[model samples]
Target: MAGRAGDRAPKARRIRLGNREVVTEGLELSFWADISHRCMTASWPAFIGGAALVFIVFNGFFALLYWFGDQPISNVPRGAYIDYLYFSIETLSTAGYGDMHPQSHYGHFIAAVELFTGIFSMSLMTGLIFARFSRPSARLLFADNPVISTHEGRQTLMIRLANERHNIIANATAQLWVFKSGVSKEGVPYRRFYDLPLIRSQSPALALSWTVFHVIDEASPLHGLDAAGLKAANVGLGLMVSGYDDVAAQTVHARKSYEHDQIRFGHRYVEILRVTEDGLRIDYSRFHETVEG
Candidate 1:
């Protein structure tokens, strides 16, 4: 007996947007498997819509249950689904109005169940909303493209970013990484990553703009790589900025990536800082503006 031909081939893995690698061959897990976390992390509109839908559906279901029994809710109009629905809402919210309420053991049991569901659901939704609002996120803005230009009489790789928030971000740090395809000494093709050394990667405070520069000298992996070479090798430059935001009172991070084509050679960023009669003025309209070096 021999194994199947398909089984002999190794599975190919795919790198996703967030650098997450997934094997092509595997048991695909259902999103419902981790529904709690998914709900907590879901977008604002999605989470709110889901909660609204659940609330309506739950009331509708209980209304139908009340309609099935004889006079489950006292003072509700005879055979009126709408009236039963209203009663269900009141019971679920524990807002027992004097006008109508549970009239029998069956009614009491159903109301009890709805009350419990309402409490638990409200608590879960409150926690998720608070988590989303409290999460720390950086508002750093990166330049549209990276540039290569002359700096201090040497060719340098430059990237610019600004802290959009007026508040201070303490102990800010940045890192630049380059990913490119290359052939190993053994003639095997592989993807390689290199950390470019920056002139100044750390900042005590970041309230305005910061320009990061990496000297492309002999020590750099990109020393010999020209624009054409970079394109041929499928280069990608990744920039990461992290800092402790005073206003947020927590660590926040932001990242951006530029492809080979997005790197402009012999180019420099335009000036964005200027002094006005009132005070310092930053023209954000020209933040991404550039000029040929």
Candidate 2:
């Protein structure tokens, strides 16, 4: 009876990006089953470390093979593991200095194998490095929290962002989405997504700062949502910005999400722009700062 009950139990879902939950019903394979994708998507340190480890391990394996062979390498000190290891490195890198050459048939076979492996490994590493370096990324800085404040005599939801690189992003576009738990008319619980219409979603040129606003009017999805109501509904907001980076000559994208607790009611962003004697100035220290509305 216990086994049967366990089998009937529903699996827990995970929320990713706003309130999007992944349904795992009937799923057989885990996402981690693919190692190549993981390596490609892993951090820089991890990828580089893995590459170094592979190089060391491959060289060590070849060195052991040479050490076990019978007088295979010429001019290598007898029974000297270090000499064998150096020979292995030279063979694997195709950097034969001609000082130490393979003499026996066994030595030539091992050298050929190591050389082939070296070429393949080097090509794979070069492709991965190129892919990682060529990938396009954006450096947009989002405010720590979203604020609800008065804008144009109406309450509005606002999120601020700044270009950390201070480079022009041409035809930059932004979108705001709201996610909340809701009950259907049939009393079934489900997550809902609402596209919040922003007053200005596109900027011709985003060089410094941009503030996006969604007015909370009668037609707005958050028309009557107060702080408590938002919290109770497990509200989340997702913001996505994409633009053509003139400097990079590529399309760059950025995303940010704010949970219910990170949404501030009746607050306004602190002023960050100022005119200085030298030129215009932007104080990033106050980028995430806010004041009571």
Candidate 3:
């Protein structure tokens, strides 16, 4: 008897699962299943969706049985359609409510399959929920706003961005670009772009928001530039930065020129900033180390 029960175990388990893939088919039933499968591997969703479509169509086969099975179609059985729909729902939920029992052997077989289908559906939904929540959504931390100040005779632009986990860059290089109005051969309105190299380098620290500066130098097209000139030019500054901690990703951003009046010349301005727990803090006073040519 024990051996017989043990032999029944696999079939019982199989009944509870149907085809593991079958439960994940159909838009209504497959919604959660698709989520879980995509969380597992890329190929699973296409397979799951296709499989669900097949399963739903197969359910329609059962519907056809109700509509035109061997059962008498001229005079419909009282409450029989309701009974089938209710049974389908109960079986699909593994509710085993027992309020409605399948009358025929065919009906019993269908109920058993649906009961198992529900079991697998529940398991896959659980897996997908956990997988989605468990995976980290990497974040990008930028400063509250751009800072504007004057350096020498020209206006400047600055912003602070920190690698909170110190993963974005270990020794990344950044190139500054600007698009502004410049006369061209077309004689029509023109916006020209140019690259500006930082006089200094990115710091060795990782978790800190280094104060990046863009001074409109005399050599620059931005040199002797003012807000109206920039407005006429329709200017924006782009930074192309690469090199980051191998563990995390890095991004590039474009910040625009500060208004000429917004900047204070020959004065260094300080802004409050925070750092990640794992890494370092910044000291712009060090950037002051540049010796005059």
Clash tally, candidates in order: 0, 0, 6
Candidate 3, poorest ten consecutive residues by summed lDDT:
12-21
Estimate, for each residue in 98-206, the C-alpha lDDT of model 2 and write its tens digit: 9999999999999999999999998888988998899899999999999999999999999999999999999999999998898999999999989999999999999
Clashing pairs in 3: 25-52, 26-52, 150-264, 168-244, 169-244, 181-233
Residues 1-293, candidate 3, lDDT per residue (tens digit)? 25654343222111122112123322243456665454555455665585577556545555445433344222335646654555555566566576556666665566566667667866766676566555443333444444445555556655555554545455655566766666767777776678765655465544555666776667776676555666666666555444545453443332333322333334453534337696645554443222221
Q: Write candidate 1's Cα lDDT for 1-293 as tens digits.
A: 67677775444556455343445764354678988887877788898898889899999999999999888888987669999999888887778786988889988888889999888887887887888788899999999989999999999999999999877999999999999898999999999889999999999999999999999999998888888999889888899999999997999999998888889999999999999999999999999988998
Whole-model alpha-carbon lDDT for candidate 2 = 0.90
Q: What's the candidate order when arranged by decreasing TM-score?
A: 2, 1, 3
The number of the candidate with the highest lDDT is: 2
* RMSD of each predicted structure: 4.0, 3.8, 18.2
Models ranked on lDDT:
2, 1, 3
TM-score list, all predictions: 0.87, 0.88, 0.43
lDDT score of residue 226 within candidate 3: 59
Global lDDT of each model? 0.89, 0.90, 0.52
